[model samples]
Target: MLLLIVMVNSCYVPSNLRTVVFSSVNNNVCKRLDGDIVLYAIFVDSKFTNPWSKYDIETTLDSIRVATEWIEQKALEDSVDVHIQVAYHKTLQGRVPIKNDFSKKTLSGTLYKKPLWSGVRDIYKWADKIAKEAGLSMPRDTSPITNIKNDLKNRERLIARLRDHYQTDHVALMYFINNYYSDEISATFDISNDNNVEFSIVSFKNPSVIAHEFLHLFGAYDLYLTQYDVKKRDKKKKDKLMEMFPNEVMAFAHRNLSSLNISDFTKYLIGWKKEMPVEYQRLLLKKGYFTAKY
Candidate 1:
C-alpha cells in the first residue's frame, strides 16, 4: 500500500507541473476578420567590423522577403489586406563588445578602446554608466554597453527618426552580426531591442535564428525548449511535443538552408495569412526541402 501511494504521487507530480490554468476566456482576439494590417521591415546598416559578405546579406534579405511573402499569401487566402514595406538603411553603425562571450570578470575590467571597436564598445559602456548614475539597476549578466534600457532608448530614437522620415508606424527590423554573447543568447529580438520594431540580430552562423525570433513578433511562442527545467514542467507538455518535430526552419538545428519548413504555429504568429498574398504562402510552403506537418 505504501509503494502504490508513492507511485501515484510521482505520477501526479508531472501532470500537476504540466497543467497551466488561465482564468480569462479565450477571446480569439486574433480572429481573421479585421482591417488592413501593415508590417514594415527596416534594415539598418550592419555596424560590426566584420562586414557581412554581399552574397550572405543578399541571401539573408531574400530569405526574409520569402518569409514575408509567405505571410502575405496566407493573409490573402483568408481575405486579409496585408501591406508590408521593406526599408533599407546603410548608415546605422554596429554596437560592440558582443555580450555572453567573455566571463563577468573579463567584462568588468576590460576597457574597450579602438577605432571601430571603441566606438561600438563605448556606446554600451556609456549606457551602463548613465544608468548607474541615474540610480537604476542593470539586469544580471548584462554589460553596461548592451543594457536593455539604453538600447530601447537608442532604438526609440532611431524609430522616431525613421517615422518622421517615412511618415508611418512601420515595424522596424534591425540586423546585426555576431551579437551573441557566448553562443547562449538565442537569435532574436533582445528585450532592449524592443519598443520601436521587432529587432532581429542574426549572426552569420545563425541566420535562421532571426526566423525563430521574428515568429515571436507575429505571436508565436517558442515550441522548442532545449533548456527545459524539470521543476517548470507542465501538463500540456508543449515543449516536449515540440521536440518530436523534425529539424526544419522552426527548430533550432537545421544546417542546410533548403531544409527549412515554416509550421502553422509560425504562420499564426506573424499574422502572415491576414496580411500577405496567397501565392507567397504556397511558394514558401512548397519551396523548402522538408516534409509538411503530419
Candidate 2:
C-alpha cells in the first residue's frame, strides 16, 4: 500500500528557471546553466497480457546504458555538465493491462492518444506502491499543474513519492514489455512549477528511442510533426528531416552520434541556450506556436 502525503507547496518553481505549460500536467522543465541534473532510471518489468520477463530486462541493460551515455555525452558537448545516474527499481507486475491493440478512436492515424495521462497515472501509482513496499518514504514537497482539476490529489501523491524515492532532480522509467508498435513516450508534469517530476516510458529497450524520450523530459520537443500538427506531416519525405535538422538526434534517431548533433532549437528548449535563436523563433511562429518577446 502506498501512503499518500500531502505537500503544502503544490508546485516548486525555481527562481532562475522558467517553465512553459503545454497542458495541465505537462510542463517544460528546462535546466539552468551548469546545473547538476540527476536522472533516476528504472527498468520496469511489466506483466501485461504479453509480459516482459526478467531475462528480457537483463538483456536490455546494456542498451539502456548506451542510451544514458548518449545523454551524458550530448550534455557535455553543450557544456551543460549533466550527470545522469541510472537506477533499477524492483520489477512491477499485475497492474492494469496496457492494451497493445489500438483502434482508430484511440489513434488519429499514426498518432496515439488512448493511454493519456490518466492511464500513465495508474501505472505510476502502482510503481509507487511497489517502491514503498521496498522501504521508501514519499517526499512532502510537490507541485500541482495549474488549472488541472482531474486527479490532482493522486498526481500530487505520485510526484511526492517519486521525488523522495529517487532522491534526485529527475526520474525516468523504462517500461520493458512485450514488443509493441508504439514504444516510447515522455511524461511531463507541472511544467510551469517547481519540484516537477518528469519521466519517460519505453516499451522496448531501444537506445535511440530511450535517448529521444529522455530528452523530452528536459523540455525537448519532437522535431517530427505528427497528425496533431496543423500542417500535414508527410511520413514518406525522409529528406524533410535531413534538410531541416541534418543529424539532429531528436529527428533522426537512427543516425549515429558521429552524424548527429543537438540542434539550436533543442538547446534553447533544454536551457543550454538562454534564448531561442532568431531563426528557430521564426520557425515556431510559423508552426502556430505564439512566441512572446522575452
Who wins the lDDT comparison? Answer: 2
Candidates in order have lDDT scores of 0.37, 0.47
Give the residue spans of candidate 1 off by over 4 A. Answer: 1-49, 92-153, 178-186, 190-198, 205-208, 228-236, 243-249, 252-294
Writing each residue's lDDT as its tens digit, candidate 2 over 1-294 gives 101111112332323334322221224333332344444444433323245555665666777778777777887877777776665544255232232322221111112334554544455454444334322223234346444322324333443455455565344433343444453333333333455444444544567666666666565665664333454433433235447787787776655545667787767656667566666564543444433322
Given candidate 1, what's the lDDT at residue 99? 23
lDDT of candidate 2? 0.47
Residue-wise lDDT of candidate 1 within 47-100, one digit each (tens)?
322444566556666766665565556457766676555554332242212222
Candidate 2 versus truth, CA RMSD in Å, comes to 9.7
Alpha-carbon error at 30 in model 2, in Å?
6.9
Worst 10 residues of 2 by lDDT: 1-10
TM-score of each: 0.47, 0.61
